[model samples]
Target: MEIPAPRRTRIQQEKRELILEAALEVFSTNGFRGSTIDQIAEAAGMSKPNLLYYFRRKEDIHETLMQRLLDTWLAPLRELDDIGDPLTELRSYIRRKLE
Candidate 1:
């Protein structure tokens, strides 16, 4: 059996994160129909092929980012429960939003 090599540098990891962040910004601003791999690559300061290496397709990138956003949005709501007072819970929720 063969094993893949791990990424050798923190820079590569950072670059991947940058690419994802840029993709999210571009996709959010332009919507899926209007965004292109070239645009995302430019926004990420990377080549189209490099972007493709991280994400096989534009739809794949969009889906991954959307799922991430949904997870983030749902996390706070999940923290709310029936145990807290309404006004205090609302204030805590507002603070979480600002945070």
Candidate 2:
């Protein structure tokens, strides 16, 4: 009988998330103008080629991360509607901003 390969566990997913988080931190701190793939790979504790595997290019990683951040930021704002009580809505907006 052939053995099947094991699927990734939650820990593996969490590690990937950690690597992405590290990449975002490094990118934000250095800015696109000053950052390099080597820097990100170092920050992520992965080799440059490994980082490239996760993200094809520096710009690709930056764009993907930035888009995810924008989507998250927009989600709460999109929930806001003009139909709600003004004060309550404003309060919720403030809370979301804080979040």
Per-model RMSD to reference? 3.9, 5.9
Pick the TM-score winner: 2
Question: What would the TM-scores of all predictions be?
Answer: 0.68, 0.69
**Per-residue CA lDDT of candidate 1, range 1-99, in tens?**
899977548877787788889988898899889999999999999899988887889888888778888998777777776799988888887778778
List residue ranges in candidate 2 displaced over 4 A: 1-12, 85-88
What is the lDDT of every predicted structure here? 0.85, 0.81
- Displacement of residue 72 (Cα, Å) in model 2 is 2.7
Q: What local lDDT score does residue 58 receive in model 2, on the 0 to 100 scale?
A: 82
Give one digit per residue, the lDDT tens place, for model 2 in 1-99.
Answer: 999966768966665576678778888898887888898889888888877756778888788788998998888878787899988988998899898
